[model samples]
Target chain A: MIKSNSTNSNIQQIKVAVDCIIFGFNDNKLELLLIKKKENPEKGKWSLIGGFVGFDEDLDEAANRILSDLSGLQDIYMEQIKTFGKVDRCSFDRIISSTYSAMILKSRYTEDKISKYNAQWFPITEVPDLIFDHNDMVDIAIKRMRRRVRNFPIAFNLLPPKFTLPQLQVLYEGILDEELDKRNFRRKVAQMKYLVRLDEKDMSESRRGAFLYRFDETLFENEQNFNL
Target chain B: MIKSNSTNSNIQQIKVAVDCIIFGFNDNKLELLLIKKKENPEKGKWSLIGGFVGFDEDLDEAANRILSDLSGLQDIYMEQIKTFGKVDRCSFDRIISSTYSAMILKSRYTEDKISKYNAQWFPITEVPDLIFDHNDMVDIAIKRMRRRVRNFPIAFNLLPPKFTLPQLQVLYEGILDEELDKRNFRRKVAQMKYLVRLDEKDMSESRRGAFLYRFDETLFENEQNFNL
Candidate 1:
């Protein structure tokens, strides 16, 4: 029957919430934006920028809203990692979290407008104790990010318009959680041949200035279709 | 404000449903199992076997429900295809569908059980007009099925414990929707050395039936790691 069983019935009950795991590449370190929840149940504890999804809003839109509200960055790479529907996962209610991961270059958000709600960036390696179920979300996000980084040049989205090869390698190393051999890594990237060596050099890193490189999105997209 | 702006906001106002786009490889025909909807807003129309997901139910469980309900088969090769969240997609009060796809060898379901639900196996090349956004769902499901079949040994789960060389080839052609050069395909598969050739033959398709082939999951997994 199409009749409503309602929430009070003996049947199972579910509450849905949206959690965002934002990964940023900045200062040769991989960081994730985390908000301190000043609300009840887990007050003053670090958590993913999250809220209960509205009945009328699409999950994708809700993900965007959360990203914009907290970080002021948009049009970033975002994907649904998975849905966590464990019944007893939430203590206050039966919240099933739909997790999303968005990327932003730390340089882009350096002047981020922080709201009264305390927001801070913590290196993924040095994250603080997060409130209920958020740590699980971040863990999954990292796993997904690592897999995508291997199959595609998705890390470029989380970078500045102009960056040195060393900086690019550092970002990949941070996301992949491994040391990439400089010679082999650059050789492999050169094989793709989608990056344009810019005239400028970022002189901030060391004594010898490094030549900056900017990726050609159109060319990079075409190269992606090459299946190599 | 933990409290939502609206009172009835957090409640899942619209029904959340799941649909299974079941694909069966039989002979050389790629088939889909479609049932006549018993309930409206789209009643009596040929559509995917679908039902409302119970609260606190895992997506995999709900997918299994649709499979067993339609085909009397459990532990089939099922996967979450995608979630369709277009507003007003369903004619009723805003229903969001999370679709799953199952691959099954057509030999499993008996003709009697298939006829019980007024179900018929239609060749994917000649699928009839479906109700709701089901046609779109099937299209996406087929794409996902093809992608999985190539990388993962998911096609093996659909077949029996033993299958002939022709059977494996036919499975690939049907799912991929393309013709394969037999000698080349066999050579490539042999190069992988994941499949074991059995002495036994089906002796069904011809006077001299081809030798059966079974893939070694452990071997394929090891190869997968290396290939990546």
Candidate 2:
């Protein structure tokens, strides 16, 4: 039998990679980011924006670095989803993958930026077949995202700074994948007491203007202990 | 770069193991179930009860099997705390370990069956050195147990079928590592409202027997949607 021994003086250490499954919303549509891998085994195929976790780096730092490398954004919300370590998960060697999920505002990319071979955004409804287990990775991330949103107000990270009640409702509906009664959603949000009216109205989207509101960050932090 | 491929082609996959750090309360102290390793890679050292996950099994099933293997019990409440994947975590090649935490009832362990091997209970205050990252695993498990008992009613799983009010209070105190006011603890538990009074009382320890109560599993399940 080929002994699985760590006593070998010549065996090399395994490389670990962190992948970020970032979701965004624009034009009332959910979107996901995919990057074209530059190097081999699985080159030219679209996959997650990911890289090797460096020495002495925490998992969150590695994930944030990958985000900055591709998206040019920093200090966005991120969470550790789960570690995926099935045999043959990676085609190269035994590369155990740790995945993190994040939400981004979707105005960061445009058509001019899309010409680059590095990364592109696809609507969540029309995403292309991803390379490797990335499709599975997105599925898992969405599950965690939905679970978190139900218990925590993390969807605010993906919304515009000044948004109307309808916009907030649309984000929740698209995320939860179910229709919510507008009156009930507003009632629930009011009960949570994290959103404050900003004395401004968004008049572009509809004939009757809707009042804009801002998420109370300090209040959210204070009341977060009561949340998940 | 090393080729990221499975070690062998067309062979059975490597087995996955889940070891549990089962802690209990007795004599106003926190205790851990430690077993002596029967085989090499640190044979004859005190460690936690562990076994391999079957192809059709989930991570929790593997942990339940380990509990049965050591204490001859099933349906024990357990939580998956963390997965350990340091390249050299195990002496053997690539045994990615997932550690689970369980709060076992002290009355559940069989003395004649438990004392057969080098298996014994060690108070959290006085634990022996363990093999590999098992000590790190225990540290994380205890941390989660303490956090969970403060916010959740998981301590009920570790108590006897019919326990007194003071016994329940002591379990929480042992887990939280703090002296709780007996009146305040009673008020908090009564507000949660899942416990039912039983007609029996324990007379062995005191002249004035204490009334016993057990948790209503159906009520707990019904209120699972809303936090206790």
* Candidate 1: residue A182 Cα off by (Å): 6.5
> Per-residue lDDT for A191 in model 2?
56
Model 1: DockQ score: 0.20
The residue-by-residue lDDT of candidate 2 on A32-127, one tens digit each, is 878887778788888887887654455567788887787565676677676665545665565546677777666764545544447788888777
Expressed as tens digits, the lDDT of each residue in A116-200 for candidate 1 is 3477888889888787767888887887677667646777766778888887888887777688888878876775577899888
DockQ values, each candidate: 0.20, 0.14
lDDT of 2 at B38: 79
Kindly report which residue stretches of model 2 are placed more than 4 angstroms away from their true locations once superposed.
A1-7, A11-15, A38-40, A54-59, A65-77, A108-115, A160-164, A193-228, B1-100, B111-228
Pairs in steric clash, model 1: none
Interface RMSD of 2: 9.0
Pairs with backbone N, CA or C atoms under 3 Å apart (clashes), candidate 2:
A91-B4, A92-B3, A92-B4, A92-B5, A93-B4
